[model samples]
Target: MLKAKAIRIREPGGPEVLELGEVELSAPGPSQVLVEVAAAGLNRADCLQRRGFYPAPPGVPADVPGLEFAGLVESVGNEVSDWKPGDRVMGIVGGGSMTTRLVTEGAELMSVPAQLSLEEAAAVPEAFLTAYDAVVLQGGLRAGQTVLLHAVASGVGTAGIQIATAVGASSVGTSRSAHKLPRCTGLGLTHAVLVEDGRFADNVLAAVPNGADVILDTIGAAYLSQNIKVIAKQGRLIVIGLMGGVKAELALGALLAKRASIHGSVLRSRSSKEKAELTKSFIDQMLGKLESGELKPIVDEVMEMADVRSAHERMDSNETFGKLVLRW
Candidate 1:
């Protein structure tokens, strides 16, 4: 076993509870690869996990709170052949990715695009993978369709905008901060709505008279009613986060009239087999766009791994526009 420094939460509380500490690592098993992590990406989920509100899925380290990493392959199990020592890669994990090293299934790792640095690659996996899975796979976003993304300045929202554009769809996005809307236009956002007083239904309908064909909602209860208001007939709404709150009142009549569908998704709880399939699909469909610079990682800042508490503070403040990356 090797000893490595990592961000560990001693007790559930606040950002102050996170601290740098040592962890023991085990050798990779068959079908796994050991990676020397170069950087890790921060997510709002990390904050939820730190507060003990969201626990890591079974089999992942309960104390470590990271979901994505980019690094070089340190070693591979006897059965692995797709990657070798010195290969640069990035991927998502249930937990433990905040450490300096981790063991993950070989199939979960994707070769880092030649144009991106390890820090940039670290920001891609969770944000882009989650957005792609929700908007394309579940929401069935297609060419020429209109997609409405809540929290457009977030890591996943930024990725969703680019993904929709890459697939020939038009996108409309909303954020509490008005300034964030301009930053989204360059990513192919057709319309930007600055939500006021927790209301944006009228603006969304005004921007796309036909209404959004797909709605990628990150805010839960607070926006559920508005989402139902602006969704088009036969629209699909994919809820990927619950930052606002979990419980919400639904209008069954509105849902029935629109014939809309709502799907709640969480990436960290998926089975290993499901994650592998999603990873493969992402690599096949989105890797080329990343390589060609059509889709790029939006990194708001890169902090040292030791400053995990500060990272968490920034995310909690909702002041960050994109991914907050942590370098080891």
Candidate 2:
């Protein structure tokens, strides 16, 4: 048996609940690759899962608690191609990411953009791909269009700003802390606000004057009604997460008047087939932007796998800007 160190949910609760343990696993199955993980990205879903909110897929391990990783291939099962031992890559997984090694189907990966270090690539796949899908693919973002990103300093939010700029679109980002707003400015964010400072709608409207052509919101129900009021005619609003709460009341009148559309997406619950398609599409469409440094992943901190409890605290508290990584 091969044994690896992993972070597990001792029980659903706070940061204190994550336990560092050893787990046994079999070798990769056909069409799968075993990656020797260098680092794993901590996502909000990990926090949610740890809180007993996000359910584990059937047959998937319940304890392991991370969504994505970047590493070198250690082995490849039969029928795999486009990868071999020692290849550098980053990819998403159903779970079990915070470990020394992970098993992923062959189609779930892409070669890492050459210049990115494992440390940085840890921030790539989940946040960047999710942002790319929301801002570029689904929203049909085009040059001169305006985008509004809630949680400007977050991993997905920052990625949206850089990618929007890379695509020649403009972006406005909002954060709850005014102090964190400046950190996002260098990425070409047009306007940034502290939700505590004033009304986000007013700040957004003032910045664009014409209202947002696209809005990427994670705040969910909390911002649902307000987003409808400011979205431009024929605009697209893509909601990726609902940190605030899920249930929302809507004003259909405003939605009808503006001719805006709202979309909700969850990457984790999607089938393996859908995820493979998303990963490949992202590699094709977003690779150039990453290669040119037009789009970048922001990494706030990296800590030892042993310190996962503390890492979870920082993520759950939402004190940091960008991705938090755990190194093995």
TM-score of each: 0.99, 0.96
Q: What TM-score does model 1 achieve against the real structure?
A: 0.99
In candidate 1, what are the lDDT values of residues 1-328, reduced to their tens digit?
A: 8788889999999999999888998899989999999999999889999999999989999999999999999999999999999999999999989999999999999999998999999999999999999999999999989999999999999999999999999999999998888999977789999999989999989989999999999899999999999999999999998888999999999999999999999999998899999999999999999999999999999999878888899999999998999998
Q: Please name the candidate that would achieve the greatest TM-score relative to the true structure.
A: 1
Give the lowest summed-lDDT range of ten residues in model 2. Answer: 190-199
Per-residue accuracy of model 2 over 25-129 as CA lDDT, tens digit each: 789988899999999999988998999999778656788988899999999998898789999989988888899988888899878888898878988988998
lDDT against true structure, model 1: 0.94
Q: What lDDT score goes with residue 126 in model 2?
A: 88
lDDT (Cα, 0-100) at 168 in candidate 2: 88
Model 1, residue pairs in steric clash: none
